[model samples]
Target: MAVTDVTYTRHSAEAAAGLMDELCTVYADAYGQVAGEDTTVKADAFRDRATGALSARNYELVTARADGELVGFVFGYSLRQERDWFAGLDPAPEAGFTDERGGERTVVLAEIEVRKAWQGQGVGRSLHDTFLGGRLEERATLSANPDATATHALYEGWGWQRVGTKPGRPGAYYREYAVFVRRLPLLDRR
Candidate 1:
């Protein structure tokens, strides 16, 4: 299917809950099975966090729907302090670029997922464009697993350049995660 059939919208807190569920399901299907761990719990926790952030007006959840079913989503928040949704987590060095933009900034894409069935369908790209395109933030950043070469390729294809990598947790199957950054055009200027 063409991306044109996908519709993007800013989801309300209530709507975000459903979208987050789909997001988690996709992530678990993509990353959990190979790791020999159940990520349903983690996914649930992430959904709660996303909902809380949206309720607190700290982030916005953008969802893509096709045939009235949620297929992909991107969750992000405006940065206001030193710590954020991913606080205390060992972020890759390049994640630093996201913090360089002070005052009315956006920090962290808590999650972005597209169902495995929808992989390579341009749904992820559509979500990214709808979520980040024309935003006024000076820059945006994301941390992706280095082992996921396809994901790295996707981000790089979208103009997000890798700036650094961080060591992974002990015994973790993935060795390190890379941080990618992309500068956005000023909204007013655009």
Candidate 2:
């Protein structure tokens, strides 16, 4: 598809509240039918997940618009000590792989997607770059659905490499997902 026009908006977690419905629509439109779940269930889950991430420390949200209509968004937050999100990572990582204080050194790319109709035109990439480009984290990580090979390839193409695969937890909606990590460029803050 021809990508002739696009724009991006960066929002702090609290400020992004007004766009929740639109964000929900885009997320549902992209992921609603996954793993035997229906649109309503997936949409509801997205809402809950977004709500949780909104309260995270240093949370960030970025939305992409193509020709003035919402197409996609990317958002994440610094992983904190209390969460210890990486403690059980399979293969155990190489060593010293995460924030010592729980979440300070890493940013988690919690959710990102381009609407179904907007997938092939690089909207997702645009959202990703613009969202993470300014991050202060030393490392970034995400878990992609293993069944979605295209997403695996997309992450690889964007400089992320597979770190390990995470088995599905009991009763979790997620499938077995491939965990990937990337070292983000350290920007001078001084």
Q: Model 2: per-residue lDDT, tens digit, 104-167?
A: 6889899998888888888888888988897988888888777788879989999998888777
Going through the candidates in order, what is the number of backbone clashes in each?
A: 1, 5
TM per candidate comes to 0.75, 0.90
Computed on alpha carbons, the lDDT of every model, listed in order, comes to 0.67, 0.82
> Model 1 Cα RMSD, Å?
4.3
* Residue 101 lDDT, candidate 1, scale 0-100: 48
Worst 10 residues of 2 by lDDT: 95-104
**Which residue pairs in candidate 1 collide?**
79-105
TM-score of 2: 0.90
